[model samples]
Target: MTRTVLAIDIGGTKIAAGLVDEAGTVLAEAVVPTPTGDAEQTWQAVADCARQVLGDTSVEAIGACCAGPVDIGAGTVSPINITCWREFPLRARLRELATGATVELAGDGVCMALGEHWLGAGQGSEFMLGMVVSTGVGGGLVLGGRPYPGRTGNAGHIGHVIVEDDGWPCTCGGRGCVETVASGPNMVRWARTQGWQAPDHADAAHLAAAANHGDKIALATFQRGGRAVGMAIAATAVVCDLELAVIGGGVSKAGDLLFDPVREALADHARLSYVDQLRIAPAALAKNAGMIGAAAMALRADI
Candidate 1:
């Protein structure tokens, strides 16, 4: 018998669903705009997508990935940037939608790490950090070969780490967080303030392209963003003793323009030999990482 799971990925911009097999193949998939304002609407969006995908295949379980900071213990999710899903009961809702199937929920960051560990950048590493550098910065950790979801299943929230006490305000009601500094939208905002003349995140990418062609201000934006990210990771390395840092998402599209500065900052800030030894690399799972990781979560339940 073919074992399959219904996988859901809910983000600020999109909600993606798929029927995935044990081999991490997406048998059927669909994506829709995430409904804003109404929690019920957002939940219905996900349920509808799942129903559509399930129509194409027989799935045995449901694995969901939502934006942080989710309470995995409670099977709940707070409002992400794009929606009013505050404290919504996601697992139970999905369970209701799927009827007889088992349901599991995790932060999108954790799903990325699980995907990488199963078949992407973290394939051979025992200690891993799966990071997403997109509209928002988020991540999940695998420590000593286990998922380590913390007491509330919010352990690997790398984005919210206070890298600067005097940094910009974060959506999580914090200041100077890694997300404030390193996220694509944040980077673009910072660049615009520096007189780079960009209006949004896409403009930051345009500036990066300009920097690739020799624009100093564009280069400075990436450098500053990289430094903040590197500083945060340097701190994380000490606590998690991570062996590999796998970065993914749209912002990572900046490539060496982003990693080079991050590497330099990490090398400069990571004073400890142990922390210095940690390797940072790009995420290989790409767009499929979330669904694949959710499947991995079902298959590998030990940690």
Candidate 2:
């Protein structure tokens, strides 16, 4: 009999759920807007999406990925973006919803890394970092061909890693965190401050377009953000001896406009021989990586 797992991805803006088979194919899926008001409502939205995706299908296990910082041991989550949930008992709740099926949970960044390591950009690498640079910067690590959640399940949180000692302040109460400089909004803000005139409804896409059109400020913004990301990658590579770094998220869609600078900056910052050899690539699974990774985690026999 083929095994099936219910995969759930919870984010600040939306919640997605899918039923996936052992071969990593999504059999069914559903999505819903994340409720912002109360914690119960937000959880209800996630549960509803799960039910919608499961329907009459039976599954052997359930896997879920949510924003950090998650406590894998306690099965609790305290995502910074989801203010309604403070140390929420996510694992217990998911277990209740999954009933007879086995349930597992991990940080979204870790899930992304697992997905890429299993079937996407990091497939051939033994050690890799998967980063998401959008409204916020997030990351996860795959070591020895498996996800490493660390002691507190927050091991791969590269976003909070400080790159600049006295630069911009971060929401995490840190200075010059990767998120402060490399996130989409922060990049756009820096561009606007530098006198770049965005067409309308200014966003990272618009900024990328302006850069593509040879806008000096827009180009500079990418360079600056890319440098920060590169510095972080170099730092992480030095510490973890990563073979590859896979980048994804909304801003990553800018393609070469973003990657070229990152490559250049990495070359400049990575002076050591081993660190200089680190490779960076775009995520192959795109937006579906998180859900696919969740399924992968659930399918793990040790889980």
Which candidate gets the maximum TM-score versus the true structure? 2
The deviation in Å at residue 2 for candidate 2 is 1.1
Q: Please, what is the whole-model Cα lDDT of each candidate in the order they appear? A: 0.83, 0.90
**Highest-lDDT candidate:** 2
Poorest stretch of ten by lDDT in candidate 2: 192-201
Cα-based lDDT at residue 166, candidate 1: 93
Residue runs of model 2 more than 4 Å from their true location after superposition: none
User: Compared to the true structure, candidate 1 yields what TM-score?
Assistant: 0.95
Please, what are the lDDT tens digits per residue for candidate 2 over residues 1-303?
Answer: 888899999988789999988888988989898888999999989989999988887777899999989999999999998998999999999987766888889999999999988889998898999999998999999988889899988888999989889989888878999998889999998888888876657989989988889999988998888888888888888899888999999999998888988898788878788777899999999888999999999997642
Clashes of each: 0, 0
Q: What's the CA RMSD for each of the models?
A: 1.5, 1.3
Regions of candidate 1 where Cα sits further than 4 Å from its true position: 199-201, 301-303
Error of 2 at 61 (Å): 0.9
lDDT of 1 by residue, 122-227 (tens): 9889898888888899889988876767788788889998988998889889899998988888877877787776444455568678779887878888888888
